[model samples]
Target: MVIGAPASGQGKTTVATGLMAALSRAPYGLDVAAFKVGPDYIDPGYHALATGRPGRNLDPWMQGEERIVPLLLHGALHTTAQQPNPARIAIIEGVMGLFDGKAETEGFASTAHVVELTESPVILTVDISHASRTIAATVGGVAAFEEGVKVEGIILNKAGSPRHADEVKRALRRLGIPVLGVLPRDEAIHVPSRHLGLVPAAERDESRQALDALAQRIADNVDLARVVKIAMTAPRLSARPWDPAAEVHPPVAETTTRPRIAIAGGRAFTFRYAETTELMEAAGCEPVEFDPLRDPALPPDTAGIYLGGGFPEVHAEELSANASMIASIREAIDAGTPTVGECAGLLYLCREVDGHPMVGAVDATAAMGPTLVLGYRDADGTRGHEFHRTTTTPAEPTMAPNVHASYLHVHWAGAPELAQEFCDATHAYASSRPDLKHHGDTEVGEGLVDLAVNVRLPGPPAWMTEAIMATLPGLGAYPDATAARAAIAAFHGVTPEMVLPTSGGAEAFTLIARAIPGDRPVVVHPQFTEPEAALLAAGRTPHRHVLAPPFTLDVDALPPTDLLMIGNPTNPTSVLHDGEALRDLAGPGRIVVIDEAFMDAVPGEHESQIHAEMDHLLVVRSLTKTWGLAGLRAGYVVGDPRLIARLAAQQPPWSVSSPALAAMVACTTDRARVEAQLAVVRTTRDRDHLIESLTTLGWDVVTPAAGPFVLADSHDPGTRARLRVRGFAVRRGDTFPGLGPHWIRIAVREPSVTDALVEAARV
Candidate 1:
């Protein structure tokens, strides 16, 4: 989610960082990925402090139009915390005004641009210190100003009193956006700043304590859970994972040692894209960190050097004092080692900085310029940013042998070819289940109508088919699920840690059964049988909790069990259980696992437990029934992070094929979800029609049926054979635990097809 403001001084960073700190630390206990939506690196420092994750940037101009969503998902899925875990939500602090971007580009790299690309919901933070109800008009205008930028809510910063907040809220009531929070004037909530921007949080001795106070202030005012829910409402983003290896060119290694790329990182140089190092590592380079102010020499065997952007100008005297470090750098460059410098690095490579001696590799003196040179720069198909106030006598960067020093800051994610080329130069740095089931796939024989199974689609959608076909060329590459997991997490409003994408839902059952501890496991019968079958295969005796006719789950009737499995809108019974009841079945030592493969068949999925948060509850989802990709076997389990991790450990590597992962990436987007919703509505209409027709024929169709298929008592043991003789194949009910042969499961199709099937049955 993007936490933006109408303009600067509106507390965008304060609220964003505070929220990240609060959510990650307290009552919420959520792991948050923090981001800044532009090229500036100042605010991200505080955000990193708040979240304990490397705060990243989502710059469209620098990274390119294609990489916006991929970068966001990658950062959200991977955390650098001490105890690394998937970020539950990502909070992006907007740069400058919400819509402000490049002056000539009409907001090209704005927060709104990132929000649009990632489909992230925004909570506008407006400064109410000098305004009141007009803040409402400003926010409403911002919301109306763009399409695809969803402003979910607003936070009123520096509000005067309860009355002022109430006035703004009242005015915003018509805008239909809630006032998520109101942070009153707090003098203690400010961070000290320098010329470039806010001082690096690492440089502040009391940064942690200050951030704690800020977090407490925000937590006291903001509705953290409500914010999380709004974040969850952000639509799933669709994109293939940006694989670093795929982006980097194939490496040619001559030496046994992996080339060490000495990356400048200390109080002086803190601005660097995380992906830049990632791409280098992916290309077989060992990224070594060095400090110019303190380090006596570079890392041992440093084959390359990357001097990134920072405040070298502020530390010029100290950098000059470190004569040995400067000589170390000069010797490496003179020795023809590949070295790249950007912004501050370029300034340091010059002969002098404010009369202080420097590396002197590029025979030019450098000093603070009168004006800042900054913006998006595209040269020879390369995209980068110029963000420094320093100037050199040579003006242009020197591209001498084995060295390319410039002020241009480039994110390797956008120009991966550069990362590839650079890493190849530094080449040498070493290195970077199951199933059960009474099957659901039903193929109509010759000309027969297929009412036998509950697969909603007869064929994959055109986009999904293309996605599967796209994976065909990359089948040789071992499936890397970074993109698939992130996409799936966004789709279901859960952290990637809580999701384990399997070959199919069946594999999930096998994994959970094998990994999840439950000596007293129980499977609710008359639902899908995969859970029970998997348990039996894993050598566990599960108590069968069979519901009587009419099939509403009665938890009271079941004995106490550590593991319980059921289905939403259960198969062969078509009875949808309340999510509240299912959640009630999960507790401290108990796991409530629900198979929701058919939940997509329900309009709105009102009773699905997929989005509910319970440590012991798990939801098994499948794309097979929804997208007709049973052969591809794309499915996942969203549940307790610990349980999901266990299940993931048990899953065989690459068990879910590339095509299946691609299908998962394709099926979770907002576009696919919109299409899925329309299908659900159509299915509901046809299902109602089918029930009416079957009722008229005295087949006794079940009421309140919620899945794509409806179960009915045909009142004849010969009904399955009779339907087959009439050119229709309906599911035989005897195979299900509680149902007899007289009952049949009928998949809902088009209304006309339902009518034809009913007419054939009458014959």
Candidate 2:
């Protein structure tokens, strides 16, 4: 749950950190994780002190929008790279006010936005010191400001007296909002402040004592048990924690002395990601923390120097007075030591910061700018951030010898290549980037049985070919897909407004990725990779729900998400899910996507939800597999009119070519249906024969195969190569999420072709 306020100075930080400590200690002993809403770094430090764990941030603006809930889950469930002590509950401290976000964006990165993404309950803290029933109006306004923002309860702070608290409570009763607590004004709870908000917990004198006292007072005043109930109301998430060790795959190096990497720290440089050090360790480097404000010199034998963002402008005199450290940094950079600096670190690399002397590595002078240069940045290839008031002479990113300095804050966890590349400069690491694109066509040799690809016909039938040639004369004008959309709608028994004719079934996934608004989108795996790939291309990281052996759709195992994509008579698995179960997954808050891409190949098209009237359910179909129209790229998505309109808006004008649109319209005709059913009958016979032959050879073949492909485990790791030697090509199964190399997806074909392949397998 989020601890928000009507505005700033409402005791949000004090109450939130206090609640975390109270929940984590004594009678409750409930594990608590702390999170800050925006990019502020001070409150998290105090939060860490209160919870005995690493504090984390959840800013949709800093990180990508899709990463907010995932990062929250990462911190709560994983805590550290080592996975020690997961938290039972998480409490988020909202930044500024409830609705404050990026400047002039109408609350984009606000606490309310985070709540909308996570669907967490909001515990608003209103300072009701000056007013009685008027405070009720302020709280009422916040509750009704947005339809989605739910003010579950309120914690009134700085109550002047019992009479004053009673007046606010009496007024709040009329609004039907529970008044959780009333904390009387106290100066001791307030921490010392600086220009950049509260002074960090590490720098404050008797900070631990102050926090403990604050926590006790909060426990005495507020309802701790009730707060836990509010936090529990947030939906349960099944997100896999972000692991730094898993993100970086470095070749095994000799277990000798680990390369020492100097990391900037202390009062002047307090901003740094815990994952950065974890990534360095994973990439075979020893991170040594050195303070630029106090440390006289860099760590001994420093092979790399990473200066993170902080307030160098605030402690300029102290950093400048540390002459030994400045000289060490300058000398190392002069010797071409690998070094990277960001924001404040960028300012420190200049000759002077606000007239204070500093390292002279880059030929520039740093001073305070008139306005803070802020906001998210991806202008270059690297996605980074710029949130500082300092400016530099001859400003664009400065590079000198082996030093690169810029006012961009890049989290190495998001882009591990930055860390690996930095380590590679030490001449000790190896890179082996994996490719995700699958190509069965490339696997097929010049003269092999055509089982690698799924298309039954090498080319389109005579009628589709004639249709393509006839459209060539009409191609001079812009393509129109109105006829295709109407055909798809008529065939599916849906309205034309609820039909979206796309270039291909794959393009439908791309349209959903671009148009659908969902921070939590999940793609069920061991299916086609297109949905996951499309989500990735559109700047969304989708969680893969891998099924066990003999893959089947399990809706309950799926993570909480707004957009859920799965395949029916699924691609490689060919496992058709229950239509009713698929429909049950779609409700008020979620939109279930059924990719019936191969359903047309099923005889009678059993277990299909194409005509379901559920507004939140969509069905996607294609003509590429059964009708042999892969090159023509004909497909459409059927759903509620609102969803179809959004997808159509994402598509460009005349996206579907005229010839492909003609094939789409043609495939919906009675003659096309007869041809597809006949082809499906023949394909089913071929699939049964192959399954029988493989089963006789002690192979583990998936049962009830409905599509043109059969997933079977030959129990031979070298089966693919041996088949290639025998003039047969089959799709490798390891490319899919759950299957291993021994498993292969063999395309159903003529019995004679299957006989030859079985003979080759018998050898």
Best by lDDT: 1
**Backbone N/Cα/C clashes per model:** 5, 0
Residue 170 local lDDT, model 1? 88
Clash tally for model 1: 5
TM-score of 1: 0.55
| TM-score (all chains, Cα) for each model | 0.55, 0.53
Q: lDDT tens string, model 1, 1-763?
A: 8999888878888899999999998678888888899887878888888887888899988888888887788888874447478888889888888889988888899988888888888999989888777877898899999988889988888988989888888888989988888999888888888666678886778989999999999889999878999999987777865667777754654445567799998888988877888888877788999898988766755778999989888999999998768877886676467888888888888889999999988878888877877688887888888877777887445456777888788888888888877777666322210113446454356777888877777789898899889988888899988899999988878788878889888899999889999766778878887887887677564666677788888888886788999988798788898888888888898988999988898878888777647579899999998899877788998988988888988989889888889899999888899999999888889888889989988888888999888999999989888888889988877666667778888999888888888888888
Q: Quick one: RMSD of model 1?
A: 28.6
What clash pairs does model 1 have?
Answer: 258-428, 258-429, 258-430, 259-428, 259-429
Residues 164-254, candidate 2, lDDT per residue (tens digit)?
Answer: 9999999999888888889998899888875556778877769989988998998999998888888888888666666767767544654
